[model samples]
Target: MPQFSRHSRRGRILIAIGLGALLVGTSACTRIRTHQGYQVDKLLVDSVQPGIDNRASVEGTLGRPSFVSQFGEKDWYYVSRDMRALAFSSPKPVDQTILRVRFDPAGNVVAVDRMGLEKVANISPMGATTPTLGRHRSLFDEIFGNIGAVGAAGMGGGSGGGAGGGPNGS
Candidate 1:
């Protein structure tokens, strides 16, 4: 009986400790929950001295850029991010640091200028995925949806035909 009581007491202690840890973890994760978004950063290199700051030297000084210029190697992008909440959702960029190092024909760091989040405008937030307006159900949409939709009957699908104006003041 003594040994049984000791075992039971230990089990209860372990369960209590586990529950305490779970509560602490769940509560701690909800604090602040800050988030940073992915963007090209507001950094634009007005000038760069190629020989002074080459690709290799730049890489060694600053970390790798998030993206590179598509047209040429003259441009570099340093992207940063954080999470919003613990759930899976895109975060708003609270901050951005874009260091544009323009190279003078030769590809040297001519000038080094940094752009922080302050330079970025609210109108043009970071991120390539712009929040575009959703498509409204229009005449063309109905036609496209109903083009092959006629045969879609019994396929558990259907569409309503309501008069809707078209674009171009028609």
Candidate 2:
């Protein structure tokens, strides 16, 4: 009976340790959900009507917009994003909404447009360094290349102070 009890206790301890490890592992891998920018309320968004809703009414309904157009036609943008990320990873957009309200010169709503994740652009950098129009220079060239070029040629007429004449004017 004593031997059996001892074996059972050891088995229980092992099972408890295994379960703890599993719980910790799963918690580490669990995704973190985040919301950014404007929070959308379906009822409130639906209430905004073109022509009937002016700038003041739209602002009261949706609060402040995320951004307003700087040039060309006047437009208000309300952007929202739902993101998810695992441990130490960059957050990726799971869903996105961009609501645009176009206005006429009188500041009355002309059109209301809603866009989803289909309009989202995923841009990746082409390379480590941006391409430029010039000769490729080495680290040493960039650092020390301009050492003697400062006073050379058209650069202030060498060191004569004026033209090719010296201090005494040749």
lDDT of 2 by residue, 1-170 (tens): 99999999999999999999999999999999999999999999999999799999999999999999989648999999999999879999999999999999999999999999998789999979888998999999999988978878876635665644876764
Provide the lDDT at 19 for model 2. 100
Q: Which stretches of candidate 1 lie over 4 Å from their true place?
A: 1-29, 32-51, 82-90, 119-170
lDDT of every predicted structure (CA atoms): 0.61, 0.92
- What tens digits encode model 1's per-residue C-alpha lDDT throughout 92-137? 5655666665545565666665677776655656887666687767
Which regions of candidate 2 fall more than 4 Å away from where they truly are?
152-170
In terms of lDDT, which candidate is strongest? 2
Question: How far out, in Å, is residue 161 in model 2?
Answer: 10
- Can you give the TM-score per candidate against the true fold? 0.41, 0.81
Question: Clashes in candidate 2: how many?
Answer: 0
Best by TM-score: 2
- Ten-residue segment with the worst summed lDDT in candidate 2? 155-164
